[model samples]
Target: MDSANIVVVSGLLIGLVYGSVGLLSGFCLLSSLRGFWAEGDGRLVRSYALAIGVAVAMTQLLAAGGFVDIGKSIYLQSSFSAPVMFFGGLLFGYGMVLSNGCGSRALVLLGRGNLRSFVVVVVLAIFAQMTLKGLIAPSRIAMVGASQTTTTANSVPALLAGAGLSATAARMLAASIISAALIIFAFAHQAFRRSPGQIAAGLVIGLLVAAGWFASGYLGADDFNPVPVTSLTFIAPIADALQYVMLSTGSTLNFGIVTVFGVFAGSLATALLTGRFQLEGFQSPRHMLRSGGGAALMGAGGVMAFGCSIGQGLTGFSTLALASLIAFAGILVGTAAGLRGALRVRPLAAA
Candidate 1:
């Protein structure tokens, strides 16, 4: 097949896989964090950690095997604003808490018949578009430009190479160490391995990340016209999907938007078949307001950080970019702030 056809077909196939895996396993970062924090249930949280570990290992292996170039990913640009990415993560983390979920989680919940998620997704999409090439784009660009940092080694591989190691060796060493450690930690809990849903969530999510690389980097590869290589980032794509719905005439569907739609459709079908669909609503007006406000922060923050929890936490980290690390740190801090202590937000009481 020609490159364009390859890109389109690969994209669709990738979306299908993502939708299936996410629906079947209920993969989500916000849920994972909340479950652990509020209830002391760490299964989902560990599942997410397993996915991240697998992504890092597999992606590094791909780079070493010469199957894909990690540097080509957007997270590894020569210049990136540390402050922007950092603060962006903080905003996204905090927003996810208030919204009761992140963008991707909202999609999954919407599939399961949560109308509240519909509002969260809509507001997130609108604000994300505003941040990306929208009214807020100018200010964003200015801030990024002001705080951008130039670096000789944009990614971990490059850093290793600078330390007198070959690229291949660096990749192998990094992948081996990181992946092995994660697998050890995950499997150490025999009870965790016995939980099919959590295990499936980890494995399938990891595979989805790898599949994204195959779709965008390998299949989408074209000498003349190239599509930007990205995986499952939810913030901007939520906005882009909204725009595509309205301006179908001018806008072309991208990998992220297609995947987002596919997840909802797939999850909806699954929920129906499994009798999991239950129409749920907000407890109060305050709940609605907080959720909307959270969605707005997620949209803007995801744009600035260049990814959401899944975007930067999984896909960006998969690239092993220095920027991704900074973004992840920001995410942790923001999540902590929203979950506890001074930054903790009160839950909306039922009206």
Candidate 2:
């Protein structure tokens, strides 16, 4: 009934929608890129592009309508460490390929009874916590402190406003240009257009991101107990969820933690109802080693970057923050390294 409760409920519902859609549509950035580059299938990537486009448009609209103060979100911080964020994205991107999925994807797979994903989720959470508040925290803090820079313009819209455009005009112009570009790219592919399922996935997922902003920013705007404004992100939340499981007495429930649980539950229910639940595990010790290492990288990198793929790629990007752009670029480069060129991770031999 209260603002906090509204946010909690919204998080759960958002997670449920995301999980269900993810399971049904196989919506994942890594999978999309891999399919495009390796298999020459552009449908998945197009879906991702469309999602980003829609998210940017809708999120900006909310900000323009005074429904959300997106400037308060982490992505738009005036001071940021570009080097650290970029490098973190690189690590996360590479780790994603090695692990065969990102955090959200791992959660979905875990719900489908993939024991390998179970390992990935646990290890990723542990390392994410480590990077966030444990042994790795000091080093991460040092790196950020050393390289951080402050700027008047932290987002594309802000930059445009600085260049003589009115604030409102700047926001609309920047959002329109970027969103239109991505949408055009997405729809240019006839194959993607033909896949109504992927189109729906993109639209729904993008809308859910805006829904997240509305939930935390508007609905949860309490005078005395204001909630932190956030959208769909998995890295720190997964870590926090793990911590909550162990320290329930001392810990408090937040949107991120609840969203993690909701994602698992939604995916689990979907898997069972769709007859897709199947037990699976690593083929060998080597496989386990690779998966664990990748998860660790993702955890650490995601923290340094301040988000995972869905976190930065979609949610952060939706704000048009310059830092998100840098991180997203780093992720793309890292993914490319893992998927192609000399640094590409070769597939393991069949056990």
Candidate 3:
């Protein structure tokens, strides 16, 4: 097959694994954090830690091996807007709480016949598009421009090498130390040890992130018209997919769009196979209102940040970009606020 076809097939297949594993393992970062903070359960958090670990190790290895040019990806850009990323991350994190899931989680739940997620997905996609290139574009771009930081190098190893460390030493040391720390933390819990499914989910999802880099960077790459180098980011692609749906006649297929479709299809298929398929909807109009608002925030914020939880948290984090770290902190803070403390938003009493 040609490179385009290869990219399509690879993305679809990887997305299938992502959907299946996500459904099977219930790998929602929001849920994991809630479980840890609210219920004193750390197993799910540990699972997420493992995913970061595996993704970091594999992705860094790919960068080192020249299988992928990490610098070519957006996560490793020379400059980024820290303020936009933080604010966007905060919006996204709180939205995840309000919606009870992230973008990828909503897709998976929608595949299981949840109509609530349909609203979330639609609103998120539309708003994300708005922030990207619609009415909100000007303001968004302005903020990003005003808040931009022109970094010397985006990735940790590159920065380290620029300081003093040798290139190879920096890559190896940075990847090994960070990955090892996360790995150790993930396996530190006995609960995680007993739950093998979570471990599998972490490993598979992390590998999928690396796989995404490979597919988009190498397989989809064209000398004449190259595809963008990216991995498992949801916000922009969700919008792109929505556009593709409306303008299928004029639009071209992309790795991210195909992957989004694959996630839904994969989840749907898995739900059917496992007899977990069920149709669900909002509990009331109030619930519907909450979901809609949440979705809008997620879409807008994700665009401002240039990624969502999975986008920056997993994919961007894998690159160890300083911007990702800032976003990560913003997400955590927002999540904390939403889940508890003074900023905690209670469900509205029925009108």
Candidate 4:
């Protein structure tokens, strides 16, 4: 197949794997955190830690093997706005709690016949589009503009190399240290070690991260007209999918759109096969209204943050980009605050 076809096919297959894994594992960062803090479980959180370690290590290996250039990705941009990213991450994290999951998770749930997720997917997509290039652009742009900083060394290895280490040495050192730490943390829990399902989920998810880099960077690379170097990010893709549904005549099929569609299709098939497909909806008008507000925050915040949980937290973090670190912390704090009722979004939990 040609490069364009390669990208489309790769995205569909990757999305299918991601969707199936998401459905079976309940693979969600919010659920992980909630499980640890609220439900006295740590298996899912450990699974996340394992996914992070694997993604980082494999992505670095891909770069080392000359199969992909991690630097080409958006996560390693030379200039970024820390405060804007933090604010956006905070909004997304809190929204995950309010809406009960991130955009990707909502898609998975929607596939299971959860009508509540349909509203969330619609709201999140619309607002994401608005912020991306619509009415909300001015304010979002201004906020990000004020905090933007240009860095000579934007990523971890780059920064270390700037500190006088050789490029290869710096990259290896950074990769080894971080990956080892993550693996240790992930497996520190005995319960997680015992849970084969979560462990398998983590491994598959991490490999998918690397596969995404290979697909877009190597498989899709064209000398004449190249596609954008990206991986499994949901925010912008969700918006693009929405636009595609309405204006296919003007739109061109790309990796992101294909992946978005594949995710829903994959999840639907999984739900049916697992006998988990069930029609569900809001408990009341109040619940629906609250979810709508949360979805709005997630959409706009994802745009500002430049990603969602799996976006910045996984794909971007795999690059070891500084912005991803800041955004991840912001997400953690936001989730904690929301879960603790600090933002007054905990009415349902309190009762």
Q: Rate the local accuracy (lDDT) of all candidates.
A: 0.84, 0.95, 0.89, 0.89
lDDT of 3 by residue, 136-205 (tens): 9999989888889887877788888998999878998999999999999999899899999999889989
Poorest lDDT segment (10 consecutive residues) of candidate 2: 250-259
lDDT of 1 by residue, 1-351 (tens): 766567666666666666656767767787787777988877778888899888988787776777776678889899999999999999999998898778887888788899999999999998888899889899999999999989989888788889999878877777777778877777777777888888878987887888888777777788797877777778877887888888899677778778888778877877898898999998888888999999999999999999999999999988889999899889878988898898798866558
Cα error, residue 220 of model 2, in Å, equals 0.3
**Candidate 1 clash total?**
0
Model 4, stretches more than 4 Å misplaced?
347-351
Error of 1 at 296 (Å): 0.1
Off by over 4 Å in 1: none
Q: Which parts of model 2 have CA positions greater than 4 angstroms off?
A: none
Residue lDDT tens for model 4, 1-351: 889889999999988988888999999998999999989999999999999999999988888788888788888988999999999999998988889999999988988899999999999999999998999999999987888999988889988999999888878888889988998998999999999999999999999888899999999889897988888889999999989999899678888888888888889999999999999999888889889888998999998888999998889999889988888888888888777764746655421
Residue 91 displacement in candidate 2 (angstroms): 0.5
Q: Can you rank all candidates by lDDT, best first?
A: 2, 4, 3, 1
Q: After superposition, how far is residue 288 of candidate 4 from its true place, in Å?
A: 0.6
Better of 1 and 2 by lDDT: 2
lDDT of 1: 0.84
User: Which of candidates 2 and 3 reaches a greater TM-score?
Assistant: 2
